[model samples]
Target chain A: MIDLKRDGDVFVLRFDAGENRFHPDFIDAVGVALDEVERTEGPGALVTVGTGKFYSNGLDLEWLGANRDRFEEYLRTVNALYARFLSLPVPTVAALNGHAFAGGAMLALAHDFAVMRTDRGYFCLPEVDLGMSFTPGMSALIQARLTAPVAHEAMLTGRRYTAAEAQAAGIVARTAAEDQVLPAALELAASLAPKDGKVVGKIRTDMYAGTLAALRGPVF
Target chain B: MIDLKRDGDVFVLRFDAGENRFHPDFIDAVGVALDEVERTEGPGALVTVGTGKFYSNGLDLEWLGANRDRFEEYLRTVNALYARFLSLPVPTVAALNGHAFAGGAMLALAHDFAVMRTDRGYFCLPEVDLGMSFTPGMSALIQARLTAPVAHEAMLTGRRYTAAEAQAAGIVARTAAEDQVLPAALELAASLAPKDGKVVGKIRTDMYAGTLAALRGPVF
Candidate 1:
């Protein structure tokens, strides 16, 4: 279940399903949560977190293996979510309570900032290890968010980065103790909640025009 | 004098004029240097550096102040330099030996990486204090390069950042001792020198579309 709770001007979207894989229903639930946040009127911000030991494990590989015919459409939907998060009208943060791997890591990168748990978990892109190539949209999103050296190393090595390493690499804005991740994220979100949505949205849209073009325009 | 020297695979363009302000002739000289680097055919990269106490003090305020009628044309040329540097066909790095102020700081941001002197000097955007507003082009370049919190503080406060602070803020990739700045920049550039120019150029041009649009389109 994806639960969205409101705390003053900030919205917390918590994914409680174990592992929080991007199964079709999980994706749909997130979409609904995003819609609700957008519909609410006021200065606002969002923080996404997951229950237990996994923020997300990325794609529903078993489902994709069984439904090859839907691969293209599925990828398009995933890319759209990344684009949406990248250009969200208000400030957003990914509170990585546990592991964020593959597409999961990509999703976290889409937010304005990311806060990770210091003592446990890893942020990784395992596409190379899985013998898969990144789609153009995925590549663009990562390249846009990271410095050249960091992006090159992460994409090529499939390294599992600890929180301290992620912060040093500029992958995550900050890191906190295991139990403090959500609180840290909420505090960061609240600080930025007073910004006007339209202005922030425009700045982000303009800033990431290239990444958006690749994600939203076509599979190519 | 602006000097272009080739050290193996790296082309170093060092601006030696006092304060290295963007006077008309100085801009012309830099353009000529850029043209020379581009015209040469090789697996190579470019590193821009400066001598003495200032990397660059931005525009020639005295000249611009005296020739107010030519402001529009002058700004066009200045912005074109920025756009040119931003899309340079090979990897580029700026080694800031001293202060990089206003347009100068924007120049450093245009490069693929920047290395600043650790013990002295500062990186600042003083338009707010100078009673001037940034052109859309200038604003877009800074916003595209830095994270939102850093961008907000730097733009609004015109804060002079120390080398340590700049690296921590993600404004520069690295920092070095005064005598080590240029060598560090050259080493960094050399590491990325073998990349195909066309691919790198295309990536940058596409990635920074919004900034290029504002820079190349018009004064508005």
Candidate 2:
């Protein structure tokens, strides 16, 4: 279950850790959030969270390891779901309840910003360890956003890091006190609410989506 | 005139500076070179260069200063001209001759790899210094390829550096021998020629253009 709750000027969106992740329905939920943000006229912000200790394992490794055919189906669904979150018009912050591994790590990176527990667990895209690479496109996006050295080390080696290290690597915006993580993220969202959402939104949108728009026409 | 010369297992695409530093027709010549590379049927590679000094200051900055009223017209033409260069379906290398400032800097970045001179000048995008930032889209592309510290400093200060530092910062792939820059670039292109272009092309295309095939319909 995903709930969008309003606390003060902030909109807290909570995602429940379920038996199924990245379902077609979940993808639709993300699109709805983006639409709401784009059409909203008031001052508010959105913070995404997950229930309990898992931000999301999407096609849990155990399940995928045992079910290959199902994994492919899940991948297609996961990719579309992630793309919607990336397309959101407003600034987004992902508050990782605990571990965000593999596809989960990719999800966290797609957000405009993220916060996690420094001591509890780890975050990583160990898909390479599982014998694959980031979709070429997503790999390119990571290359653009992070220093090549960091990107190369993470992808090629499939290393995991505690939340503090993720912050140091410039991926995690900040590490929070276990009790303070969501609150910290909510606070950050609240800060952006007063600022001109249009300007902030424009800058973030241009940062992520504007590049492709400019290249729309046939160059050849 | 731009010329393609072969070295040991490498094909170098050298752009010789003509009448106008980055000859107005230079952009077109680049497009033609790319078209040929595409037809070659392998992981395409090419390196750019200028005759003596300066890879290219890009768009004859001085010319633009005098033609402000017609800048819009000039820009539309240049925009159309560079479109093909940006979208070339091959992995290209920028073998910068000398100074690559403004448009010169952009042209260099469009490549998959680049080598710059260590003797003197380096890259800079001083558009913001010109009392306007007309390349909002370009800014996004550049930021993705560069480090935040480097991107922030370059865009905010408009400072230029020696080629040596540019290479270290990953702005330039590597510095080349004064007279052998073209030879070096050609060498790299040829080396990569034997690799499976299918994979390379698939990777590059996916990176630049995602399933962006239909922007209107539900992405899924």
Candidate 3:
């Protein structure tokens, strides 16, 4: 369900599964794709996109219901994925084809930049409405990526923001028509692909040290 | 000198010292003013401003040169001040009449919002250029207040941002002509004065628990 392809200097990772939830197998597939991207010799960047109606709908609740015993372990693996994308050696962009909700929206934030399809889709975090509080790591990641006021409003109110609103709120870097979303991300990624990957990674690592520590620490 | 005056529901704290560097006496005076602000009953808010050409220039290096042994203690006090302002029971706004550099810039970030003079001043963090690094608390504060890209650029490059640029980068909530900075800040503060102070404080404290922990922790 995960397709990793090379387009010039950009590695495009496309999620074809319906609703692209974080199933364990899906996570493993993405991890393997990332391993290959990380090993690119020189001048590389990444773009992640999704098929049709959904970019991603966050965690797989159905799977979690069946595997309740692995809750903590599952969350730990998910948090690690966020940290990895946040500190990836190459520039990365998320091209949102449709809805990005909760953990899915966060996955987009973990990337260096994001481009959303303006005509459709939403970026939302509904934990508050669902009677849940964010883990310390998740909170840190959100606060790290967003400006204070935006973070406060989004987290406390669980607002569903459209692409235009998200861009204005500093949540997404750009917005384009549905068909142009991936192309826009690819263009932006290719432009940044020439930067030294190690330096980019090092700078991001230092810049987000607190976030990395929080994500790598205990979930409680 | 620090001047605290009651203007309707808003308390205006004006810093009159030349350069407004954080000397021990200045710190103590500001602390006293803050105590008064905290004691405010009913609807209340705060607006801080500076005289002449400086909002504040940050650390009192000249004073530090003479009291070398107090470096850690002094920084602790400054950090505490930041924490206090960040978690104040009422809404707060900073009116940047002129330059806000290094620690001073951080002071602005601690406020709920800021309004800066649009002409003849700058907002900067020169630590990278000065061969110094941010303490964990300072870094946390900056990251918390800014979007990731803006934080990355500011912390790494030590760029001097004009008021317009600062506003565009989400550094300040608004910008006004030189003569209107304080008025703009007061207007914003006044508008927010009716919010339940306890609720505001509680939400901010919970939202920034990590930042408060870092600020209240050891400087090293």
Candidate 4:
């Protein structure tokens, strides 16, 4: 289930369901959670994190395998999720307590900042290893968020970056031990909570227009 | 004088003028040098370096003060220079061998990578202290190139960042001693020179669409 709770001016959205794959039900729950946060009166920032050893394993491959006919629609749904997080109206942070792979990695990249657990967890985009290639939207998103050499390595090699490595490579803003990831992310979010959300939103929207356009464009 | 020298697949553009301020003649000379680099066949990358105590002191305030009538046109010229550098059809690296202040800082940020001298000199944006505010275009450019918090501090405080501080704050890609800055930058440029220039150019253009639009828009 997707759980959203408010603590002061920050909202924490936790994916409690195991592995947190993008299944239809999981997507619906996250959408509802996001809507609630967006409509709330006092939230200044949002942080997304997951429980257990897997922050997210990305797309629900099992579900997709069973519903091959819905692949296109599923992709569109995933794109919408990424787009929503990318242009969220307030500051957003990804608290990576566990592994983030493939589309899961993209989700972390969507946020303005990321805090990862240093003792464990790996951030990776394993599309090449899986014999898949990034769509234009995904490619644009990666390029927009990462520097040239880092993006090239991440996309081509499917390397699993440790927290220290990711921080050194500029992937994550900071790192914490396993128990501290969420608090660190919340602290970061809370610090920037006073800025006007609409203004921050507009700046982000304008800053990432090209990537947004590509993400929202036709799926085919 | 602006100098363009081809080092195999990398073209090195050196600003030999003292202080390397943006005088009209200096601008024209740099433009001509850039054209030569653009015209040179098979140049896979570009590295911009300078030969004095200042990589560049930004605008020629002395000239601007004397030629008040040319102020508007002069901004356009400066903007053109920045835009050209921003979308150059090859990979670019800025070798900041000495102080890079104001517009000089912006120029370094436009490049794909920057190597700075760690021993002396500074990287600064002193507009706030100078009783000036950034134009929309300049603001957009800084926002595009830097993280929000870092950009906010640099623009608002007009801090003179030491090389170590600049690297830690993500302003410069790497820092070296005064004698090593150019070589480090050249090494970086040369390493990435095998990549297709057109592809790199396209990626940069799309990634910085918002900033480019503002920089190229009406200069009111």
Q: Which prediction has the highest lDDT against the true structure?
A: 3
**Model 1 lDDT tens row, B133-181:** 5666877889889975577557644679999999989999999999999
lDDT (10s digit) by residue, model 3, range A61-112: 8999999999989889889989999889888999999999998999998998
- Interface RMSD (Å), every candidate: 6.2, 5.5, 4.8, 6.4
Misplaced by over 4 Å in model 4 are: A1-78, A84-104, A110-161, A168-214, A218-220, B40-43
List model 1 lDDT by residue over A119-220, tens digit each. Answer: 999999989989987879899999878777889889999999999999988899889998899999999888778766656665566667678989886665
Model 2 scores a C-alpha lDDT of: 0.64
- Weakest 10 consecutive residues, lDDT, candidate 4 chain B? B195-204
| Alpha-carbon runs more than 4 Å astray in model 3 | B1-149, B152-163, B172-220
State the lDDT of candidate 4 residue by residue for A55-117, as single tens digits. Answer: 888999999999999998888888888889888888999999999989899999999999999
Pairs clashing in candidate 1?
Answer: none
**Best first by DockQ, ranked:** 3, 1, 2, 4
Question: What is the C-alpha RMSD, rounded to one decimal, of candidate 2?
Answer: 9.7
Which residue pairs clash in candidate 3? none
**Candidate 1 ranges beyond 4 A from true positions:** B1-162, B167-214, B218-220
Question: What tens-digit string does per-residue lDDT give for candidate 2 at B1-220?
Answer: 7887654434567766652254446666766776676677534455667767777777766676777776756655555444444455444677776788877786676566677777766788787787646444456445645778887887788878678878767687678778767666677656555545444444443443421222111211
> What does the TM-score come to for chain B in model 3?
0.99
Q: Give the winner by TM-score.
A: 4
Fnat of candidates, each listed? 0.06, 0.14, 0.17, 0.06
Residue A31 in model 2: lDDT:
62
The TM-score, computed over Cα atoms with residue i paired to residue i, of candidate 2 is 0.54
- How far is A99's C-alpha from truth in model 1 (Å)? 0.7
